[model samples]
Target: MTATYQELRRSDLPSLRREIRAGHYAKHTAGLGPGFLQTNLAIMPEAFALDFMRFCQRNPKPCPLVGVSDTGNPMMVTLGADIDIRTDVPAYNIYENGKLTGSREDITDIWTDDLVAFALGCSFTFERALEEAGIPQWHIDHDTTVPMFRSNIETVPAGPFSGKTVVSLRFIAPERLDEVIAISRRFPLAHGAPLHWGDPEKIGITDLGAPEWGDPCEIEEDKIPVFWACGVTPQVAIERAGIPLCITHKPGHMLITDIAEDAEVPVRNPRAA
Candidate 1:
């Protein structure tokens, strides 16, 4: 049952996961499953679970806590009935001693009893809300990853986890800024509203054309740059921790959950074109 990208965008949660689990999709999950909740994955050893939870608590803007898996279990019952931490996401980043070892579609080979999975609320959830409100997302429209940058702001330390916050960028028309902020504010689990808009330099982001992760977005004279607390902020902390092992969903490669905020929205298959 092969489905085109346009088909998958309108697919039900289960059908999409089937494709992802089969290793058929391993890319940024921005426009797909637009109304449902999405999570940034962070699987850490049992020993670091408590501290990581605290870290999320201290920095809810970037690390909004959504669902947490049992210490040894791969299933995320809190997020969805069928969410398997190992194979559900589009891609996984494997780290050893705080270094990125590799990235792959599945982590079943390394699944262990001591690993605990965390589902951090992602801004992808809000991007859909923005689009629904008629706010444009340049990166999604261009089929590119949203640019992410590190800000000078520091997160409150939780055990050994502490670092500057990361932010996801989008350029939206100046006239739509207030309306977009209102729409995005509705999803607390999705990082809830822009942290800052306009001048990127105010946030300590010196370079607008270059980004620390994801693709650089083209500047538009009409649209102002908007920044939102990014779920990838945790990955920076994970890397700085130097833990023996850590696994995270690659930036923008999120785990889609069944929790729908806008299920009533109708989807059309653009492949009909």
Candidate 2:
């Protein structure tokens, strides 16, 4: 069956993951999964799970630990119903020994018994909330990838997982800056709030038009550049760790979950059913 964006948007948790795992649809999930949780994915070897978890604990801004699968299991049942780590995301990036090897729609070939999956909450969820609040993201409106830059900010070091924090940039009207920050801070799991605003160079971003990942958005005359911690920071960290093998979702392509918007950001560690 053909899966339309509108159809995907309203699907319950198990149904959405099933559709993604089927491999027929592969597209940026920017505006879909309304009022639901969408996540950034990282699958790593068991050897690095403890250190990576510590890294997330120390650096909550860039690595808000949402859910972690049991060692060697791709099933993220804790996050929602029927969530599979293998093929639930739209796309996947495979890295070998600190270098990007290739990307795939599914990683059944590389699936191993030593792999552990981690799901990080994404700013996309908050961006959706902002839109619902009547504040639109320029990247979403322009149909472009959100601009991301490697910031000078360093994440707290943990074992082999330590690197510069990457941030997503958005251009917003000065009048809406207060509102944007205020609303975003409510969703702490979704990168919760902005790390910096106004000057890009202060954060080591030299060019606003050229992004390290994804497409760039225009900074209008009336709008000022705003930045938020991105979940992609782990991709950079995995490269630094120089692990033998790692897998992540492609930029803009994310794993949409069954958790409703209100349930997306965890209020407490509710045990998986």
Best by lDDT: 1
Question: How far does residue 194 in candidate 1 sit from its true spot (Å)?
Answer: 1.0
- Model 2 superposed RMSD (Cα): 2.4
Judging by TM-score against the true structure, name the best candidate. Answer: 1
TM-score of each: 0.93, 0.93
Off by over 4 Å in 1: 1-3, 262-273
Q: lDDT score, residue 80, model 1?
A: 73
Cα lDDT tens digits, model 2, 125-228, are 88887888888788888766798999999999999999999999988889889999998887777888899999899999999888999997776767888999
Give the Cα lDDT of each candidate.
0.86, 0.84
